[model samples]
Target: MATSNRPNAPELDSACVAAYDHAVRQGVFDDSDVAEQLALGEAEVLRIRTVLTDLRLLIRGEDGSATVPASPEIAEAELSAHLEAGIIERREQLARIHRQMRSLAPVYRAHRHLPQASQSVRLVEDPAAVRRELAAATRACTSEAFTVQPGGGRSPEALNEAIARDTTMLKRGVTMRILYQHTVRANLATRTYTRKVTELGAEVRTAEEIYERLIIFDRSLAFVPQERVGGRPPGAAIVTDETIVGHLWRMHDKMWQSASPYDPRDVDYASTSEEIKASILRLMATGLKDDVIARKLGMATRTCRRYMAGIMDELGATSRFQAGVRATSLGMVKPDPNP
Candidate 1:
C-alpha cells in the first residue's frame, strides 16, 4: 500500500489505538467484529480505521479492507521517521521566518531613535502603547524590578497575568520587590500569589498606605501614572532621566524599609489594624470624609465607617470631630495644623 503523504494527519487517540490493539491480538482485521467487541458505533469504527491508516499502523489489502496490523517495530520506525521529517520542516520554516524578520531589525532600531522615543521623559497617553512599552522594558530588565501597587487586592485575572510576567523575570534571575497596601494581607488570592512568588525568591511587603503606583526597572527606567484628573483618560509617564530615576529608586527603597514583610501565616493583623486606624485618624484630623479615607487606605467606605465607629467607641467620643480631638489629646494622631 502507498504511504500517506499527509504529514499533519490526525493523531491516534486511546479508543482508536485500543481498536488497533484488538485487531492485532485477533490476528485478523474485522471491523464489524472489532466494533461488536469494543462496543463502538459503525462511524466510530470507520474513524478508527481512517486514523490507523493515516498513521501507517494498519496494512490494507488491494480491496481497501484493513487486513493486517503493521508490526510494532516497523510501525514505530515509520512513525518516528515521519515525525522527525515534520520537525525538520517546521524548523526550516521558522528559520526562514526569523531571517525575514531579522532583515527589518535595523529599520526598527532607526525608528527607535525618534524624538519621543529618545526623550528623557515621555507622556504615554495611549493605554495600548503604555502596555507595549512596559512589556518591552520588562523584557530588557536585567538586575531588579520594584513595584508599588496601591490597592487592597488585584483581580484574579490581573494577578494571573502578573504572575506569568513575574515568573519569567524571576526565572531570568531578576530581583523583584513588590509593595502593596496592607489590605492585601486579608485577600486570599493575593496571598496565594505572594506565596508563589516568594518561593521563587521575590520579596513582597505591605504598608498602611502607598503614595502611588510605580514600577522601576534596574534603577534606570521608571513608569508612573499621570496625576489623575477628572474627565481625562489614564496615562503613564516613562522616566529615563538618570537623576529622576535615581530619586524614584531611593524613594522606593525608603518605602520598602518602612513596609512590613508579607507572610500569609505570620501577618501581625493587630499591628496592621492599628496602623490603618492611625492613618484613618490622621486623615480624619485633616477633615477628610469616610469615602476619601477609604480611597486612600484601599477599603470600602462602609468598612471605613465601621472602623471609624470602633475608633470613636475606643476614644469615648460621640462625633468624628470629637474623635479626632480626643485622638490628638491621647497622642494617637498629630493635630492637622491647616485645619
Candidate 2:
C-alpha cells in the first residue's frame, strides 16, 4: 500500500471519494468503526463497501468473509487489466458479427434492390425494424431524399439525431428536400436547425398543413406511417412500388411548390401568425372541431381553441358559427362549396 506510487483514482462521488480516502488512511476494514468515523448509517456504509468492491478497491479473502482495502495502485492495475480483457473480448465479438453479416451481404443486396411483385410493399410492424430499414434506405440513396415531417416542432433530440444523417447525405452530394407545417416557424430549435441545414444545400419549406409523414429516397423507395388499428403501436410501411412511389413524389412536389421557403432571419412573425389564423379560420369554416383543426394544423387543441377565441373576437362574433359566417363574408376564407 505505497501512496507514493498510487495512480489517481477514477472520478467517483464525493462520499465514495471520502470513504476511499478514509480507507487508505485507516488501512483497515471495520464497518462499525468506519460508520462512526464518517457519521454514516449502516446502509450507507454497506453501499460504499459494495461500490468499492465493484471498483476492485475492496478485496475479500478466499473465504469471502474477510474484507481488506486494496492499495490504490493494486486496485487501478487490476481494474485496468479487467477492462482491457473486456475490450479484447468485445472487439473479437464485434469482428465475428461483422464476418457473419458480410457473409450475407450479397443476399441482402440481391433482394433489397430487386422489387418483385410480392416484395413491393413491406409492413415493418416493429419500431426497431423500421429504424433499420430507414437506415438502410438512407445509405442506399444516391440521387435525392425527400421528407415530410408533419408534427411541427420536432424534439431537439430528434433534430440533433437528424442533423448528422442529413449532413452526411449532403456531403455525399445527394439533394435533400424537407417539408414541415408552418407551426415550426414558432419553434426556436426548428428555426435554428433550418438555418444550419439550409447552409449545407438542403431545401426546407413549410406549408399550412401536411396530410401525413413521408420519407422518400431517389423516387424509388419510400417510408410512410403504417395505418393504426386496435390500439396497435405505430410502425412504418416501406414502399418500393414504382407507381405508388411516383404518386407520393408527385404529391410531395405539389406541396413543395405551394410551401414557403423557410429562412430563420427572414421570417415575418406577424405574417406567419396571420397565416396560421387564416388557415384555422378556413378549417373552422368547414365545421371542423377544435381538436381536428389542431391536429391538422399541428398544434395542441388548447392552442387551437385560444386561436379560435382570438379570431372570433377580432371578427366581432360571439360564437364559432357567427365567426365563420363573417369570415366568409369578408373573403377571409372561401365558402365551403358543399355547404
User: What is the per-residue lDDT of model 2 for residues 220-304, given as tens digits with 9 covering 90 to 100?
Assistant: 9999987666666468878889999999999789889989888776767888899899998999888889999998899889988
Best by lDDT: 1
The candidate scoring highest on TM-score is 1
> Candidate 2's error at 178, in angstroms?
0.5
- Backbone-clash count (model 2): 0
- CA lDDT, candidate 1, residue 132: 85
Q: Give per-residue CA lDDT, model 1, range 270-313, as digits (tens).
A: 88888788888999888888888998889889989999999999
Error of 2 at 161 (Å): 1.7
Regions of model 2 farther than 4 Å from truth:
1-103, 106-117, 228-233, 335-339
What TM-score, over all chains together, does every model reach?
0.72, 0.66
For model 1, what is the error of residue 40's alpha carbon versus the real structure, in angstroms, after optimal superposition?
13
lDDT of 2: 0.83
- Cα error, residue 275 of model 1, in Å, equals 1.5
- CA lDDT, every model vs. true structure: 0.85, 0.83
